[model samples]
Target: MNIQETQINFTILNRFMVLKKKERLAHAYLFSGPMDVGKGETALGVAKLVNCENLSEENYFCDVCPSCLKINSRNHPDVHVIDNEDGGTIKIDQIRGLLGQVKMRPFQALKKVFIIRNIESMTIESSNALLKTLEEPGGNSLLLLTVSSLEKILPTVRSRCHTMPFSALSLRVMARRLMSDDGEFPQEAHFLAHFAEGCLGRARCLKEDKIFIQKDAIIDQFILSSKSEDFVKKILTDKPKTKGLLDILLSWMRDSLLVKVGVEDARLIHIDRLDDLKFFVERYSFFVLNDVYEESVKTYKLLADNLNVKIPLLIIKEKLRYE
Candidate 1:
C-alpha cells in the first residue's frame, strides 16, 4: 500500500508533513507502537518527504525521483539504519559508530536520517553512548527510533526525543486493508484481521504463515481437550508453540467473555468466529467463563515475563476443564 493509504497513525503523518512544511520538525523522533503497525513505514515516509526532490501535495513522494527511489529501495546514502544485527542487541559499538556517522555531513540528501529499529533492544551502555548525540545533534540530521513500547526505553532517552504514540487500526480498517492488499484472503479476511490485532502488515504475514494454520488447529484441539481422557497429560507433555497458543487461547476466552456480556460485534476481536465463541460461552457459567478468561490473561502474562511455560499451560488446562 502507498504511504498515504496507511490506516494506522494517519494523523501523525499529516502532522509530520505540516511540521516539515513549516520548517519546525524535531531533530529526533521516537515512533513507539505495536510491531507491524506502520511505525517504520511512517519513519521511512518522513525520510522521503525530507529528501524528495519533487515533492508535491498530491503525492508525498514523486515515486520516480532519484531520492525517493533510493529511500524506497533502502539504498539512500544519507538514510542509515541501526538495528540489532548482532545477537538481537544494539551494542555500544554500533551506537558509537552511528554517532560517528552523525558527525559527518549528508552525502546525497539535504537531511541525514538515522532510522533505529528496535531501539528497546539497546544495551544500557549503548543507550548512554547515544545520549550526548541526542542532546546536541547538530546539522540537518533526523533520528527516528521505532520501539514497541516506551516503558522499555530509558527515561532519559525518551525525554530527549519527540515521542509519537501509535496504535493499531480498527477491525474494519484492518479487514479492508487485508482484502485490498491480498484479494485471495477474502474468505479468511475477517479472521486474519481480528487475529492480527489490527495490524495490516501482521494480517498479511498471518495470511501466508503456515504456523497460523497450525495455531488454529491447536486452539481447536484445546477447546475439545475436555473430551480427551488424557487431556492434561497430552497438553503437558506436548511441545506447544507457547506464545502463539496462549495468544489464541486468550483471544478465544476474551471473545467468549464478550459474547457472554452482550458486547457489540464491532468491539469483539474475534468477529469472524462469533458463532463458535457463542457456543463456548453457552457451555460455561458466567463465573466459569470469567475465571477462564482471567486465567488466560494471567498465563499469557507469565509466559511473556519469561516464566516457565509448563506450569502456566498446566494451570490453563485445568482451568479449561474446571467446568
Candidate 2:
C-alpha cells in the first residue's frame, strides 16, 4: 500500500508536508506500531515527497515523475532501505555499512533517505552504532525507521529522533478494504475484520490461510470442549498462528460479555453466533468473562514481547474450566 492510502496516519502525513514546505523537517523519524499498519508506506511517501521531481499537492508526490518511479522501484541511489523483509536478523555490519552511505552526499535527490524497516531486529551494537548519526544527522539526510515495538529501542536512540506512534484503522475501514477484494474470505466480513485487528495485511494473510473456518472450532473448544488445555497446548506449540486463534477466542469472550450486560449490537463481532454468545454468557458470570478477556489480552501482550504464554493461559484455562 502507498502512503497516501486511507489507512495511514493522516495527522503525521499532513504534519510532514507542512514541515517539508517550511524546511523544518526532522533529520530522523521513528515510526513505531503494529506491522502493516502503514509505517513503512508513509516513510516511502516521505522519501518520495522530499525527492519528487514534479510535485503535485503540497502533501503528495507526482507518482509519474522519474524520481518517484525510481524510489518506488528501489532504483533511487539516494534512497536506502534496510528491511528484514525475509525472516532474518538485521546485523551490525549492515547498519555500519549503511551508516557509511548515510555520511555521503545525495547522488540525485535533495537529501539521502534511509528507510529502515523493523528496527527492532537490529542488534544492540547496530543500534548503538547509529546513535552518532541520529545525534548529529548533518549530512542532509532523512532517516525513516519503522519498528513493530518501541520497547527494544534504546532510550537514547528514541530521544534523538521524532517518534510517531501509529494505530490500526477502524474495523469498518479495514472490513471495507477486505471486501474490495471479495471472495478471499469464507466468513462474514466484520468477523474477519475484527479478527484482523484493523490491519489489511493481516486480513489478507487470514484470507490466504482460510482462517475463517477455524473460528467456530476455536470458540467451541474454549466454551464447550472438554480438552481446552490440550487444545491450547497444541496452539501454543505452533506459536506463529496462535494470535489468530487468540483473536477468535478473545472476540468470542468479548461478545459473551456484551451479551451478559445487554450491550449487544452492531458492535458485536460474532453476531451470527448470538445464540452461542447468549448461552456462553449464561454459563459464566460477568466477572468471569471479564477476567477471561483480560487473561486473553495478557496472553496477547506476552506474545508481543516474545515471552512465554504459559502463565496467562494457565489463568485462562482455570477461568474457562473445561474440566
Q: What is the lDDT of residue 127 in candidate 1?
A: 92
Best lDDT among the predictions, by candidate number: 2
| Among all candidates shown, the one with the greatest TM-score | 1
Q: 92, model 1: CA deviation in Å?
A: 1.3
Pairs that collide, model 1: none
TM-score, predicted candidate 2 vs. hidden true structure: 0.81
Badly placed stretches (over 4 Å) of model 1 are 4-9, 184-187, 227-240, 261-266, 305-323
lDDT of candidate 2 over 285-304, digit per residue (tens): 78888988988888898898
Reference-based TM-score of each model: 0.85, 0.81
Worst 10-residue lDDT window for candidate 2 reads 1-10
The TM-score of candidate 1 is 0.85
Give a tens-digit lDDT track for model 1, residues 1-323: 36546543667777888998999988999999998898888888888888989988976667678999998899999998888886499999988888888868899999999999999999999999888889879578999999999999899999999999888888777777777766745436777777887888887776667645755566567764665334434544444455667777877787787789997466676665677777777778888888878887887787677676666666666666745
Evaluated at residue 286, the lDDT of candidate 1 is 82
The models' CA-based lDDT, in order, is 0.78, 0.79
